[model samples]
Target: MKIKLKSGIDGLLFGMREKDVKELYGNPSRSYKDDEDNTIYLYNDKKLRLTFYADEGFRLGYIIASHPDTELSGTKIIGQEWPALEAQLQQNGLKAFEHETFDSVDNYFNEDNWTIFQVEFGTVVRVEVGAIINAKDEFDWKFK
Candidate 1:
């Protein structure tokens, strides 16, 4: 499945309604209310998680795709080596900035509204795509 930046994943658009998501992806494996009182749907089999903002008519606010089969610009983001993924992002005109925490390293692609988390020294375990709201100076961290 090809992932679209700041827009959607596969055929799922960011502004789509909650019912639309369930219709396309089937019922979520589980659902939970977020801190903001919005609903979050998880499709564990597909390794996909979607967050909806109730205030915005339950529109899709975030998409987190962790399946290795999920591709962006023909590049498989999950399970990709860090260096190769970084190179791919650069070649695609997306700037990658590194953020290191106590446990893992995260690479943020600001323009693409995506963040890649490193599982190890070289492997990527997760990819978060959404409308990043807390972009502080050169670092883009929060996904809204």
Candidate 2:
């Protein structure tokens, strides 16, 4: 699937409702609440994990796509070496990542758009993208 920067992969925008997501991808293989008490829909077959935050009007707030299958600008993002992947991302107009590592895993964060590439053993394992709109104190949204 193609990555759309701050937007979502494919047509799954950042501010989409759970009902809308269900309509598009059908029922998830498994459904449960995450540590944060948000609802998580896991589509194992599609290698996708979508999180809907109850506080954000239950809109789709987080998306986690697994390795090898997810592509960015036609380039497969997972399983590539860190330096090569970083250069490729820069060539695609995404640049200047702040890398954080713990144990054997590395996370490259682009604060520019909240796109995170989680790498392990020098290869990317997953990609996460999401948005949290603070447009209003309550009952309002401005997608970022």
Candidate 3:
């Protein structure tokens, strides 16, 4: 069965403590400590780093995920040449839904991380991200 959960800090109330989120998601590939020393989590990759920003109250500002999987036909994948990847694709091949039809070679996002690409694919194909439900009111923020 598929389940959805809120993404922002409000979602953190569903038994998802800060430590738990870290443990499940793994140490952010990198982290940034604000002027106040509040830590913002980051998942770093060659092309993208999923970042989590926190406000004074620890509420998530937003989630920005980018993809760099699409590549130019003549360019190199990590400096190895695009032809090599294409050749490999033809050999190993990807899943049916993992492919995209790029109208032009210039329409690709160049980055080192492929996680964002996978996320984009999932979203474009109706795959879901963390969900938000049972929204917490100001009163909900109070944890005695």
Roughly what TM-score does model 2 have, to 2 decimal places?
0.88
Give per-residue CA lDDT, model 2, range 56-91, as digits (tens).
Answer: 767887899984678988888878887898998899
Would you estimate the TM-scores of all the predictions?
A: 0.81, 0.88, 0.31
Error of 2 at 66 (Å): 0.6
Q: Rank the candidates by lDDT, best first.
A: 2, 1, 3
Candidate lDDT (C-alpha), each: 0.74, 0.81, 0.33
Q: What is the TM-score ranking, best to worst?
A: 2, 1, 3
List candidate 3 stretches off by more than 4 Å.
1-17, 35-38, 45-61, 68-144
Candidate 3 lDDT over 1-144, as tens digits, reads 111113322223322434655655666767676676545566554222222334424433223333233232322233333344445534643212234444432122212112112222222211112223233622122222
Q: Candidate 3 — what's its lDDT?
A: 0.33
Q: Pick the candidate with the highest lDDT.
A: 2
**What TM-score, to 2 decimals, does candidate 3 have?**
0.31
Point out the worst 10-residue segment of candidate 3 by lDDT: 110-119
